[model samples]
Structures are given as structure tokens and as C-alpha cells.
Target: MATKPRMHLALDFSWTQVETDWRQPTSWVNRFYPDIGLFEDVARICERGLFDLIFFGDSTGIPNTWEGRIDAAVRRGVAWPRMDMSPWITAMSRVTSHVGFGLTYASTFMHPYYTARLLNALDHVTNGRIAFNVITSQRKADFQNYGYDELVEHGERYDRMEEFVDVCKKLWASVDPDAFVWDPVSGIVADPAKVRPINHVGRFFKVKGPLSVPPSPQGRPVLVQAGGSPRGVRASARFVDHVFGAGKGLALMAEQRVKLDEALRAEGRDPQQVGILWATKVIVAETEAEALRLKERLIADVPMEAVGAWLSHNTGFDMSTLPPRFSLRALNQRIVAANASPVGFVGLLAEQYGEDMEISRDEFFRHGLHAATGYASTKAGTPVQIADYLEEMFEATGSRGGFMLGHSQAGHRAVLQNITTMLVPALQRRGRMRTAYEGRTLRENLAAS
Candidate 1:
């Protein structure tokens, strides 16, 4: 059986417009801090779509890589004023039963014990309806915020993350699930004998004892990772339950799946164990022509400066500093050499234009600048047309993990509303999506497809 495909809402990217456009009447994010209204409504919408989970990919600091300045990022809301998503996950879980929540946390700077305790408590709070999107932080400002002089090299960070996750796992297992036996007759709460110290001494992290919190309903938070580099793929194969992917289209995603499966087999693990959910942007409407028109409108609204800022932030290169003659392929080479962060879709640009093909400055601007317009892997169609595209991708990639859609126009609410009310029902009618969740815990629900 083709594991009934799974779907999740990529909140971080989708919610980007909220801050800039929040004052607009259609904006979902009414305010910045304590986004109670925004989150609750999003949770209900995702739940109605029968989404397996709603996830946020977060960062810790204000990015300043663009033009060697933080002004653009801060002003444009390019991942600035970042809020800790942990609190919102708990709040969302309160209103929904089965839709899971995944929160990103960097393994680079955080102590293993703290990570273990925090997520364990959340797992309990959500009744195991939680996943941790483990990320290896590479942003220089993020490192500086944590009292580090510089960010570690990419490979070394993942190495440390491996040990970080190891220590956390041991701490989570420090207290046995069956150890807690509430016996009012003898006034005993837990079996002390069953609890033992992990005493994990690792290369990157050292933890002394058992976690104070008891075991969560799902034992441990599901591990979600998004690492595209070779070392990253290997690390994910060893530990991750879900791997987030980004590509330009279904063909590229299928290619990535092949690579991920190879990594899993190399690690002596079954390829089926890890789900590959490609990060995608989707636009849907009552008709295909209307969706195309919406895409065009969205493209026109995107500020090119925001694109440059985002690219600079991600690649650690000031777009303005580069020579005017620089080609997109050249930029990719520079990023690959720096190992600053995942090159992501930019790396795949070479596939479209042959390696030797030169994408001129204007050509590069035409494609790269509109990334914020939400067109990468973007499908524009009616409900059935969108459903058909999703089904085709599922069949092509053999994606047991399914898709993570980040609606670029999420602030409009209409896009999200159409998805839950129109696209989802279309999928269900075709038996491509679930009518209801099959499991109680997020882990179980995830295991379903």
C-alpha cells in the first residue's frame, strides 16, 4: 500500500505576510505578540483539512546578511521579531484534537537537557501531538545572540547536532513510562527503582541525570529535519522521522527522494522509515484561470528588494556587493564554497539551465527575485485541478510523507479558506485525503501516512 499521503501546513513561510499586512482587514495576524486569534483560526482550518500537522520553521535572531545590514530584514519582516512558537503549539493543541504541531528548535546553541525537558513537557501537554523540527543554526547573528563569536562550520554543526539529539534521547528515556504507578493505598507515586540517571557524556553535550518530566504519550517528540547537504541527509537518516525537502517541482522532489532513500539504505535503515515532505507553495481558486490570475497578482506585489534581502540572509552574501555581471550559477558556487546554509532551490537552478549555461543578471532577477511571491513548486488551479497535481506528485515521488504547503498569500485568509473548504473536500472525495484522523497521538497520525 502507498502509505496514505500526509499533509502539513508550513506556517512560518505562509504567515510571512501577516506582519507586513496585518493592518489590512483580511489579515489573519491581527497583532504580533501572543498571536491567539491568528493561531487558533489557523489550527481550526488545518484540522478541517485533515492535515497531519501544522509546523513552524523558526530562527532566533534578526538577520543582517543582506547588504551587510539588518535594516532590510527588520523592515521587510524577513524573519525578524521572531516569536518562540512553543507557547502557540500548546494553545493550538487545546482547540484541536488530532492536528499535530511541529516547532523548530536549533540544536546548535541549546543545551540538550533543556531541549529534552521543554519538548517532553510539550509532548505531555499536547498528549504527544507534537514534533520537533530540529535545525542546525547557521545564522551568524543567531550565534552572536548565544554568546558565540562565530557560527560553526556546516558539517561540524550537524555532527554536534547528532550528539545533541543523542543526549536528549537518553534524558527523555531517563524515566521509564511504567515507573509511575499511582498507588494511593501505599501513598506511592512512582517506582524510584525504575528511574535511573542517564549520565550521558557526549562529545558535543554532557547531561548528568534523568529528565524531571515524565515520559510523554508518544515516548519522544517526533524528529523532523530539513537538511539538504550530504552530511545532513546522513544525519537525518540516522535520527529523523520526517525530512523536509524543497525543490522546484515534482520531478525534482522525486530525485530528492531517490537520494534520501539511498542515504537511508547506506545507514542500514529502511527508506520507508523516514517521510520526505517537500516544501511547496500552492495557489488554488474556483477556476484554473482565476488561480493563474491570482499568481500573477501575487508576483506583481512582491518587492524585489525583499527577494535580495532574503537571498542575502540565506546565503550570507550581500547582493549589492556582488558584481553586476555575476551569474546565478556563480552565486551557487560561492554559496557551496561558503557552506553558509542550504543553497535550497537556488542550487537546482543549474538543473534548469545546464551547468555551463550562464543566467545573466536580469535573467537571475526575473526568477530569483519573485521567490517571495510564493511560486516555487506553486500550482495554480481549481480544487480538482490542484488535487490532481497533488496526486500526480504523490505518485511520482512515492511520498509517503506527502506535502507541506505554505500559502504565500496566507494573509488574505481566502486562500487558506479555499484550501480547507474546497481543495480538501475534493481530495477526500477522490479518496486521496482522510476524512478523519486515524490516531490519537501525533506520532500515530504521522505513522499513518
Candidate 2:
């Protein structure tokens, strides 16, 4: 018999207004600092349900994907006008006793020494309630800050990432977990024998460390990886605690799982030790029809241009190059078939809704992010149906859970209310979510081997 599933329901707090009511714009601005009271509310809700974590997602560079300007992204409340996710995590820690904080930094952007320290500090502050998403972003402009005129080829970037992760891990392990005693009488703090420099030299970087930061709870904030490429799967299989993706459907997700399984086996890992979370959206109402109605309201405030730009960024191509007749095969051939299935889906969406998406660039900017690239779901009328759908989703994808919401910078409360009031109860009743946290610290709750 399948035991109840334990879900880690993290809110993407849209950080902006989600509705077209136009009465409240910029609701998302507050999540940057995450008003202490509101954050405390989220922590309370998640902890009440024993949710594994409540983390924030961030992009290192601007979301200026369309026509190379930030206006379209800003207008639609896509992702342009957001605040740094790091500071916000401290707020999350201050307010919550549990619910691990997922903060992100790209391997391609930040140096390992600095990146490692921030995570260690936060881990110390959170008492082990921290998770880090390692990313390689699509923004070419971010390269300017990294001293590059252009982004490295994806293959090279990931190859370098392998070294990056290795270095970070070595730095973490180099400092034994029990190295610090702070013995005042003996005038000893850390045993020099326990703390040694990790001499890391590779294709991308070389750092002699002794990571500058002291180790904290969960050893290192549990590592999480988000990318769907073949290389991404391989890299993550070796190192990450969680892998996040937009599972296209049951069949595709199953196929992807098989690939992930093989990767894990090759790396000599127990596949069960690595967790997967799919990007998902849900609408729940007192009744099923009511839920569908709620969804219709959501799509209206969308910016289609943002969706197009998202598709382009997925494949690192220009949206203008996407034609109505653009088939997956043709598009794949354009990139010499080095494309991921993510690109193929863009081809599918463009072929399916090109006419509706072909508005002025500004008009389309915020239209489609809500048009999920992953699972499309709705649950109306009663909690039973919601539980049934969640069960079905898990059965279909072989994922432990779903990344159930988005555009959080647009509205945090809507997501909080949904998971707390609707989703969590539904899953709990069905025996799919944890009834209470089984262990202490965020990692014990989420990363059980």
C-alpha cells in the first residue's frame, strides 16, 4: 500500500497583485522584505501542517527577454521588478520556527567562497532550515558583471558547474561538523586538524579553501538543482537533494524519471534519496465548476509576451524566430537537435496558440507565465476531488510533490490560503501529506535517505 505522501509546500509568493481588479498593484513588493507579520502568518500555516519548507525563488539578472527592454516585463508583473531573495530569507527565519528557507544563487554568477559563506551563515541562523537552489541562468547581460562579454555555451557552463559543486562540497566537508568547541581555558576554538583547505583546481576554477564560513545545521543547506537538460540531470543526480522541473505530462514525467533513475544508478546513488518536485498550478473552489471559473479569472490578467519570452529563454532563442508553423522537429533541427523537450513544448504551444499570442510586444508580456509549462490542474467543489487530483498527479509523474503555485511576487496571501486551507487539508485527509513533522530541523523533515 502506498503510504501518505509528505509534501513540501513552498509558496512562490508572487510578490505582486494577481488579479486584474487594478485596485492593488505592487502587492509583491512586500515579499522582498516579507512584512514580518505576513511572513509569520505563512510560517504558522506551513508549520501547522508540518510542511517541509517554504522557500523563495530568485533570478540573478533582469527578466528583460522581449525586444531587450525591462518595460514589458515590469508592466505585466512578470519578474522584472523584484527584490533580492537573500535578505528576505532572514525574515523568514526570524518569523518561523520551522519551514526551511530555499534561497538561490547561480553557480555561474557567484564565486564559491562567497556563495558557501552566505549559505553557512543562513544555515546557522536558521538552525539548519536552509535549502539552496543552484542555477545557471539565461540572462546574457548577467555575464557583463561576471567579466564575460557573452554567456558561455550551455555545455561549457555546466561542465564548469560540475567543478563548482565539487569545490563547494569539498569546502563543506573539509570542515568537520564538530570542529568548533571554543575552549576558553585552553585558548582553542577550532582544531586546526579538523579545518583544512580544500585545494580545488578544475576546468572552470581553482580555490584553495578552507571555505571562509563555519559549518552549520544540515551540514550545508540541502542542495537543490533545477534544470531539465541531460547534463542537468546528470549533475543533479550526483549532488542535489531536490530537483525541480516542469513535468510536461504523466508520460513525459515518467520518461524523465527513467532517465533520472539511470543517472542515479550511474552515480551509485539510491534514486529514492533524490527528490523531484514538478511546477504546478491549482485552483480550488467549493465545487469543481467554481474552481474552473476561478482559473478563467486568473488567465485574464496575464501578459502573453512574457510567455513568449519565457519560451524563447527556455531554448535561448529569439521569440521573433518562432513562426506559426514552427514544428518541434524544425526547431530542434535549428539547434541541431541539441534542444531539450522544453523547447519542443514551446513549439507545441506556439503552434497551438500563436494567433492569440501575436499581439504587440507589450500586450503579450504578462499574458502567459500563468499558462503553465508544466501540469495544468484545477479542483473545484469539495476537498475529496482535490485530494484525488493530487494523488493522480503523484501517480502520473513519480514525483514526490508539485511546485503548486507561481507569480508569488504578485500575491502571497492567495497561495498561502490555497495550500493551508485547501491543498494541505485535502492531501492530509487522503494520507498523502505528513500529519506532523517527524524530525527536527528542515533537512530531517525534507531529506530522509
Go through the candidates in order and give each one's C-alpha lDDT. Answer: 0.75, 0.63
Worst 10 residues of 1 by lDDT: 10-19
Question: Cα lDDT of model 2 overall?
Answer: 0.63
lDDT of 1 at 169: 83
> With candidate 1 superimposed using the best TM-score fit, by how many Å does residue 447's alpha carbon deviate from the native?
1.3
Off by over 4 Å in 2: 1-5, 14-40, 301-303, 309-315, 321-325, 332-381, 399-415
Q: How far is each candidate from the true structure, as Cα RMSD in Å?
A: 2.4, 4.3
